[model samples]
Target: LVTIVAVNQTGGDIPLSQLYAPNSKIPASGSANLTDYNRVEEILGDTSDLGRGATLEYHPDPNLLVAKTKDAPSATLDCSVGVVAGGTSDIPIAEEARIIAAESGLDVVRAYDVGVAGLHRLFPPLKEMILRDVDLLIVVAGMEGALPSVVKGLIDVPVIGVPTSVGYGYRGGESALIAMLNSCVPGLLVTNIDNGFGAAAAAYAICSRMMKKREE
Candidate 1:
């Protein structure tokens, strides 16, 4: 919720949206372009409110831009975050969010390879996650972006949806983003395309508030 950075896709027909796309020996590198720099400049243009929103970082090898939100939560409450990936291709972003949640001192429980391709696969691990009683669940998906809504319907915990750039002709998460945005499930939280960090940040903020209320 702090900063916004805009960047354009490089390809014409099948864009190299994600570095880990199928048959995508496409992206040569993850270099930041002028537009990226300019976007950063625009976000950092005014330092009116400092250290409140987010911090931006770039991954060089695969060339990803990530913004992580940080804040320390209470040590007393045994806070935990559950992260689920719709498919194997979405693991990197899921792991990134999990790492951030762990760094913020929340125990992270993860289940992978449970995408909506097979509905039967999601239940066992999902039951385990719910049994653990996590403070929040961060669901990462691409394609039709149906995982988050499914998770939300099954659980009462806060659900954060991350739409990755994994679908065909979805334009690097466009379809997934739209799916998440249009989700009829009430109270389902969502992040931008491939934005795992934002989900983690939102998770941290929510968990912290809950912990504070518990203390109060």
Candidate 2:
């Protein structure tokens, strides 16, 4: 028999001692006692089939804890650290963020091409960096300039948006900059278009503040 189960590891134990199926939407806090085991298989259908063993994928749930790797980094840090994530337009932003961070003597984690177009691609790496306890997140996106806003909504850390000139025509970069400036997400920051270095500088400043706060 092939069975799939979802366990919440955020709180150190699964609430109500229950496991959810992949299709289940786990609430932040709740109790669901699924009585029919066959229903899960029906939902998964032939998708769970593997050559000889079952494959399990971990999908994040806002309400429940997703299992983290054993060797995951703790949320405490020794120095200023940040993560630079890019989407769609990947040429210079991620690289520039790393360079700026390094020059400023800060640790930087880079995740490339995690734009909203392939939305799910960004979460895992983002989560990993969060686990590593980064002090800030810099999201570089061109075209629509939406990735930063999306990331800010999911994470509590400060997000600096770097809009690049990856689109065609003069209007392309301007439009992206406008979109970033007009982002409705509260406390979101927008740097000048194609300004990865500026974003990293802001991140370093934030890290400096964090260090000061920790010392206080």
Q: Estimate, for each residue in 1-216, the C-alpha lDDT of model 2 and write its tens digit.
A: 112222222322222223455455433332121222334445345433222223323221111112223332223224545554555445466666655454344677778878777888988888888898877787877887788888888888788888888865257577778887898898789988776656765776677566668789
TM-score of each: 0.66, 0.60
Per TM-score, the best of the predicted structures is 1
How high is the lDDT of residue 176 in model 1?
Answer: 90
Best by lDDT: 1
Candidate 1 per-residue C-alpha lDDT over 69-141 given as tens digits, one digit per residue, 9 for 90 to 100: 3331222235789999999888878876775565455689999889889989999999998899888899999
**Cα error, candidate 2, residue 197 (Å):** 1.4
lDDT of 2: 0.58
